[model samples]
Target: MDMVSPHTKNTTELRDRKRTGEILMGHGYKRGAAKLIGVLVALVGFGLVHGRPVDATDKVRIALSVRNVVFLPFYYAKDRKIYHKHGLDVEIIQMRSDLQLAGVVSGEIDYTPAIGPATLGAANSMPVKAVAVLYNAPLFSLVTPASVSSLEDLEGKRVAVSRIGSDSHRFGSLMLENGGADSKKVTFIQTGSTTVSLASLQQGAVAAAVLSPPFTGIMAEKGFKVLGRSRSLVESPWLGLVTSKQKLERQPEEVKNMLLSMRDVITAIQRDKADVISYIEKNFKVSKANATESYDEIAGVIVDAMFMRDDQIKKYLEGTHARGETSKLLAPEDLFDFSLVRGLK
Candidate 1:
């Protein structure tokens, strides 16, 4: 047999070394991890090219649809970035109606700032729960020209509402019926006015319209009179925080933390109105006067009441339900999951 050359033996040794390194380092398997890395890099690049969506598990998403003066504190909370300060990655989206349940069930959002209607939704099997009570009571009213003089004058005259089934429309009807007005006698107009219901009356569209402040303040300054105010303390309603049952079960810690954050912000608002008014004006595009006045109004009427002084959650439901305002009675538990407010600071 021919003697093996030393150079050939060295070359074979090098080849063996290379094969051994490959196998140890997972060469065939490298493609699996490399491909994963490449896909991740491409995804990150895409997000950079466009906009990165929030990390679902890491972000706290909330949807708010019940809009108005009662809900203004949420705007203040959002505009001020209070949720973030509390170790939350919070997102606030504005929706035009009480569509909280769809988002809750589908996981499009983690919670809603308005929990009143969600109380109604819970009764209907939407699998949602309230995290906290924002306003201790309702903050809505029917405003009209001072010339109208009384709620009686509102009949036969056209009335304006944001939509057919909005809190304004439903509660306005209840207010009228409670005051003994025939619902059919008044003409209802849909104007989509969220915060400026008073403007509807100014524009000569209706004799009376539901309103929230700064619009309420503006109308009062402009010589309009208050017709009916939604008063939860004396048989009205409350707005609170709501989320899907799934969120409650999956991320109870996050939900609790967010509520604590919100309460801190709310307390801060009262604690520092001058600063909060500046912030509200900057973010909401309101007149400085409106911001200042509205902030003051909210302290007495909206915040710090725990859903009404008497806490008659049942009486409110009975009052509204009897007047055909809401379809049925709502359990108090249906309105709030106080564990967060009760447990967390």
Candidate 2:
């Protein structure tokens, strides 16, 4: 046999490497050092003409204030693989609203679905901006012991809220104001969460508590009086998705994918009432009856598009100012970016 030339020998070696890589891949070895080496061999053999290497899927971290039904859409999106369908790997973290702001601004967290007070932090020049409204009306209700018949009865009594500057407190104050009761006369004790607020109410530490569903439903089931709901008192954007403006500008596609996922979630909420209730029952750890009650309270107000109208943002800003949370009144354009939602169907 004739001796093979050096060039032919090199070509034969590359072909052998390519065949080995294909065999390894065919044997279901698509990970670890073997996969890396296979990819390298293929790259060197094919040269740059084979096109660029495949990029890893993007991962997004989202924070939520609490595990409540208000964020049903997000829960649904995760459980139903909607985020995966959008080509994103989403991680949901339960964090306090105060902490979430810092997370978003520092780029530690990519997105947050926050309440009014938390979202208002954007007005203070925080890097985050509210991109979409999740809940148009408040989800909280002033629940009291059976002895108290109405909001008027709780004038001199102590009420429990999540915190002083929290959404629960805002809803409680708004309810008191709408009920024509003096909010100042009613002391708001901070219980840290709706569950703790309920505990406080049950233990007689508080006469009433600003509890959102399914806690509110539990209270009602236990004979607590539903004194009033925040929906009647407040119509501002109670909850919404917030992200850094930098992310909005630099990662427009990711932001758009997130909003698209949300849009689908909202549509699911509207079209499939039973599925939403089931999700609420599973995620919130509540009874089906409680889930249904919670669903009924928010179904009509769940927004398909995250767009906040001029009046809605103005009302939110006014409410924020009224609570003394922020003195500066920012316009809708200043606090929100409606461009992302505009493209969503």
Candidate 3:
């Protein structure tokens, strides 16, 4: 009111604020501010900013039902450090097929390559899904002794399978049926594992066994006859990248990165067959020729992309119910989520 100009009033207020700051500094406010800044800097240095580690490599555990050439993409990714390239430290754990899906659901395993188990788990309301498929063909062979000339000869004889309700038994039955024999007539003995099943076939414990590579090649080399190869008759999504729904929903970026690494590994394997063959030979301890055979079988079936086609999904769904078994069948969209793989492309 007494001609107090706006500029003069603002300058007076600024000076008052500055004087207050100086007084507080004299009372140790400056040291407190400096300590706070130091703490923030330390947190940033330790990658604890915003409650997450920055640029940290994700440690992922992928469960393998059993080691076979169909699972070569995972092995190739680890050997070539492709997973590391995508900021992943992948540990390939070998576990029994029966336990893999349960492990995935229980959070003990992050992902599993056992596509059949993954699909079945989803149909039965397990908290899992098959995100991507790698091999879309059944890669098993019904191996028998020289005396058994045909699938019919397998009748009344004990055939070896890793387990009664295992993929080996299912696919082995399909192989027999495709060969014009009755799968029900043959007895499927649980041998605990494929390695043991192979041993059983070798030791004359079982007349025939379902074998995947390099075991298939191993048996062939020992003069065991391959009565039929499952791939020729059955074609469904075999090896796949499956994960719990929680992981897919909560940590999509991690899932995408893992799939990207796998997609790149598939490309590399397709581009350089020799590299994968060499890996098979060195890792599985098979002959170069046997490795090449295994590579040929696996290479032919490796999906060109991570996402499954409608027909492939249909084939997979149909294959799941091949034994005329029924369950609360989930829709394809509910059972599979390829959006992440689709987004990557």
Candidate 4:
């Protein structure tokens, strides 16, 4: 009638404890099969009773690059069980800065798709590897009031970017370069968030604001015109899912399955736009018209081959080289991985 008590550590770390327990028990330790069974029960009990972590691995712990059109693939993959189908636990983390090297270095997350910040991290040598492409475009746009017709109008006008060093800032800079405007012409204000930026645009705080997906779509529906969109460029020069090189070398099939899940989600985005739009609207507050625009924008960029356009990568690389960023970067070869989605044709 003797009962065993559970261990102190959480279920996610239980695997390690279980392994250690096995080692101890192998040498005739008292914390016997009963202890192992107790730990198993504890994991099941916490998950079943409290609805905590998902898989035996606890959670896939993926950092999603903000909630936007670019993330449609992940939204579908998580909703459609594609990540799960690939034997993953799959908890989608919503974050803007995907460059988070400290966490990735310390093993806090399993993976993340490329966002602009992560691309910067690669250019700076952050030990990240681009795994696959979610959408093959910039997935961002600069929104302006109806009064502003072109980038020239933006000159001497207040424009909003997320921050001075952020991707939105870079995007605004690119917009200026495209339009042949002087750098000092636009104010490049630092109001944050798509909603806040939209508000700033509406309130005359900023004549224009750079934002993404449903955000741009929402403001555009409300009479804000898209002054410039990153997708409008001839090529997409971005990265996603910048995984650690260690993961790429040790579990390449797992990486392949992850990319496969992402591609399958893209297929769904093209085929079943409406089914996913509800989430888009609920999360992004995007209007149906704007949702349509965002969805179309996403689908148009997903070529027959599921990978990013190679020419685009080459151009981006060349630009980085011109800036002398790649050589200065550590483990430059780990910056990208093209084996999975590249063969999807």
Candidate 5:
């Protein structure tokens, strides 16, 4: 992909903002917040009449669990204009894991690169389907203060997670269970996000926390010790792309384009480690060492293709059941639609 000069990119963004403002002003919206509202309105497919031809590129809104390295493929796709190259105007939205499914089901968000456990639960209740596995292994670590050397030491102490029933919660519980500590003996605190969970740990409000890359590296750099990693406890599909079945049926070409863009992103990141590292450092606001550490920790897990094995999905479901989150056994077909990217290389 050809790179756009920083000046050119900034100019383009300013022009787009100006256009949005003009459209909103014509629609009787004041200038101050019109640009923001105009962007939102355009994202939801509302036509704005500016006496100019409508944009031919399809707009897609995708949700992320948080702004972390685990979703780097989507980030790289947007940053490098891979999505645009594939004829998509992708808007990335970050939100809590629990709310992402609702956005997809309500048609407010077009795709979600959500956690496997939560995605399975959403699939069981709705027409949403997992179309791609971005990371086949859990990207979280059971981190504890330096004084608390082992998982056993966390007994009767508070542990923090992004939220209950989130990937962090499941990973923390599994880490405790694998260490022979009854998770019931530990108090799980919901910290809203990994950044906050780390803050809770720093404040000594929680003895330990389950954190993913970048934040995990940040905590470790602050003198915390990693008691365990989630990948060691479970081998399931960790993160994947999800969309409604209606989307697959109604916009097959667009879905294919999105997947193709994702493929390009994976390829780009894999082939250009320095660029990805720079992106990580700039976006996460971490040092070069921290950024490289985060990328190294997660690079091995990102897959080039979108498909997840049947056994992998089954193992994820089984793990979720073992954690007592859900009792129903869902087959691979019940949770995912592998057919979407079947022919994509």
Candidate 6:
């Protein structure tokens, strides 16, 4: 696979390569200072120091829970060599939410971008903290076949989620309750992924499924009824970077560099619209029109500076109440540390 060197690229001309078979942004206009002040006190680590490529010696591993559109930032970054530019030989791996957390906490995985599981894990007293907030709104839709006209109609029907304690479940439950439906009456099957959930829905194994774009678009095209979209049903932080407390304490430079690279991705998306839309089209295997639609729906939710407000953090933590009462008590400070992101240009 041809990889773009982080040191050079016309942002507009960047193209995504085939993922060796796996499926898998700009506003830019700012640069961090040159010279590392040591990880112990460096607030803003090396990211874009005059667009110079840092030594890519920081081998980092990031675990992705699913291949959803919300994770487009991570995918785009690797494709565009943003992490490499920041001195990170980042490896993106797919893992289940449950396992992703374990990997992060055990130092097996440096970071996992599934904010829902990470926040809930922190609430449950896990030693992991979110470093950034990517999407503040849930980009999911509670979809069912055309026979299901409303959220209430799904009572006693089966629903498909990625996993029992995963974000898909949380979003699905909230989508139902916020729509005045009894979530308890619905049976949620752990399909382990949106693609599987979609299969369950199509196979008649479930009556509804919580799916993100472009699955929602595909289902809608097939005449599925969208009872409610989570974006309108609830406001909560969806995806972002999360790492073990140990990583934060021991390798702050890696953390800060990762955050800065993410900031770079967000800024790139803000400035280059065509590249992202094209990426959506190829990455998601959707029509040009569908890709454009997904881009429009997802672009607005990307966070600025990868930081969420205090209130947004509270709301997001509250959304995990179903996990346990302890989840409701986790304050923003306990789950997030935006120092790295705050110091970026």
C-alpha positional error of residue 143 in candidate 4 after TM-score superposition, expressed in Å? 1.7
In terms of lDDT, model 6 sits at 0.70
**What Cα-based lDDT does every candidate model obtain?**
0.59, 0.70, 0.72, 0.59, 0.69, 0.70
List, residue by residue over 1-345, the lDDT tens digit for candidate 3. 000111111111212435534533543433111123234334434643221111364357776654555677887788799999988987776555666665565444578877777666666666677888888787888999988888999888899887777777888888888888888899999877676787788899889988787778887899989889888886677778888776787778888998899889989988998878888887777899999999999887888877678776876676566555437555677678888988896
How do the residues 41-156 of candidate 1 rate in per-residue lDDT, one tens digit apiece? 34334532111123443555565543343455665666577777767766554443444455455444566655556655655555667766666545567888888767777788
Compute the lDDT of residue 286 as modeled in candidate 5: 85
Q: How close is candidate 5 to the true structure, as a TM-score?
A: 0.81
Error of 2 at 295 (Å): 1.3
| Candidate 2 vs candidate 6, TM-score winner | 2
Q: Model 3 compared with the native: what TM-score?
A: 0.81
Q: What is the C-alpha lDDT profile of model 5 across 276-321, one tens digit per residue? A: 9999888767889998988887677876676767776777777666
Report the lDDT tens digits of candidate 2 across residue range 184-255.
899988877666776788999999888777778888899989888888766777667887766787778888
lDDT, candidate 6, 1-345, per-residue tens: 011111122122202222211221021223222122232112222321111112345357777655555577888898899988988888776555566666565444578777776665666666678888888787888999988778988889899877675667777888898888999999999776666777789989999988877778878888888888888866777778888776787778878989889889888877888999898777767878777878877787888868878987777666466447353577889889988888876
Worst 10 residues of 4 by lDDT: 1-10
Model 3 CA deviation exceeding 4 Å by range: 1-58
lDDT of 6 at 153: 85
RMSD of each: 19.5, 16.6, 20.6, 12.0, 7.8, 10.6
**Candidate achieving the largest lDDT:** 3
* Candidate 3 global CA lDDT score: 0.72
